[model samples]
Target: MAILRGNPGEIIKIWHGGIAIHGGLIGGFIAGVIVCKVKNLNPFQIGDIVAPSIILAQGIGRWGNFMNHEAHGGPVSRAFLEQLHLPNFIIENMYINGQYYHPTFLYESIWDVAGFIILVNIRKHLKLGETFFLYLTWYSIGRFFIEGLRTDSLMLTSNIRVAQLVSILLILISISLIVYRRIKYNPPLYSKVGALPWPTKKVK
Candidate 1:
């Protein structure tokens, strides 16, 4: 928006004015890594342990977004929402600017919950950090599609949505990390990693 308005400088000025979820996640991940280093704990194991909870938190957080009436999709019709079998109050709250909008928050919340269930179910079987990789892959896949429906997405260009771009990158990174871990790291399984002592003395 700043660039479009002939004031690219406003980009930096407006940056501190709002929070982005992707940035928040990256910040949290970095913090987790640093804490793990300081405590001499296994970061990937910790990530695996928290995977389900993280996704569940994301699912719940969308409710807050819903309450704020932000992050909705483009204009939709009352009948369209009705066809989705949404609850009456929810259908009513979607009405904004004299028109109904798609309940994207609801969509993503459902997606996140589904991911949470999957992660929890498979948590015991995955390799250390694979659950976290799966978390990233799953969330990115869902976000890539859901972001298309959002009316307020950050854009890298008029044609490139920032969230979508990040989602793609994360998806690739997750896959690459999984393969690299298996081929190079040959790390312990999620079920076994927790039994290992702290300062396993290796990042793996």
Candidate 2:
């Protein structure tokens, strides 16, 4: 609406808003729920299984931002990123004010990929539903710090950083859910035969 009101200037302002990403997350969650229902799988279990994959995918997707060169730091010389020996394709394409910017996207992508690998490898040791919580908590923790370094960040009415606020909230929610589930279900710390009251134990 603002863009159509003869205000091209407002377009960049609106584009900088985090509404699209926020909505995308909500939509992704809904889709996950639907997929779980269709598969007759436990929602939390499915979430845990998919969490790492989602992060991995996001890592790959971050390259898109790097290509655009829009999500970068305030200012930096090309030599800085070039010293890192980034791909020539990325170096040639990404620029701001005739200088290379901080590779925020690459940083985030590497972070996400590493986090996903760690989570995936350790997932079996985690309690049910706990993996998802940990994924959320860990990812948000990194994001909170990373968002602080970025030149572009969405803001609330009070000019508070929206991504930072959301990251904190997610971290809190993840911790709360993990604690709540531990208290409520009291599942076994380790898997044992017939540990759960379900299928009968087989006779030797």
Candidate 3:
């Protein structure tokens, strides 16, 4: 936007931290609390349902990158894509400078869609909060790789790719949590603990 404003030389520093990222997490947590309170559902079970939807939405949202013509990698050529048997849409729309650039957004969308499908199908068997953690893990893993390929990325003062760094950390944390829970709890989907409660349990 700043560049479009005829100030192409001007550099705008946008604050990326604070309540923005965590707001979604907090909102998800609050929604889980509300669903568990009203429907008598397990918080983890609610997370299982919500986590897939989040990924699906993210995948759908990534198309905005194509429309904006931003977030694409260095540069590429149409002939190269055609020779490699790449999709026509990509070959036609994404090539530049005789080199094929990485479509970071497309890669992320595909990864998110795949992750959503896997998480949704297996959500029922996951322990409470496991699906949420899985969402973070899977999304972060893709983000770390994709961020590295993106031409435009948020950076820290030390010239580090902030998103990639955070994504790597989240991936590690999610993996550790999943492994620890799998080893410690070993929860089953059909267990009495996981099942929806009987109606006779009256509201307080």
For each candidate, give its TM-score against the true structure: 0.91, 0.76, 0.69
lDDT of each: 0.90, 0.72, 0.70
- lDDT by residue (90-194, candidate 1, tens digit) is 999989879999899999999999999999999898888899999999999999999999999988888999999999999999999999999998887788765
Ranking by lDDT: 1, 2, 3
Best by TM-score: 1
Candidate 2's residue-wise lDDT over 12-69, tens digit each?
4645754445456667789977865665556666566678987888789888787677
| Residue pairs clashing, model 2 | none
Off by over 4 Å in 1: 1-17, 195-199
Off by over 4 Å in 2: 1-19, 34-40, 83-85, 157-159, 188-204
Better of 1 and 3 by lDDT: 1
Cα error, candidate 3, residue 82 (Å): 2.9
- Strongest candidate by lDDT: 1
Ranking by TM-score: 1, 2, 3
Residue 104's lDDT in candidate 1: 96
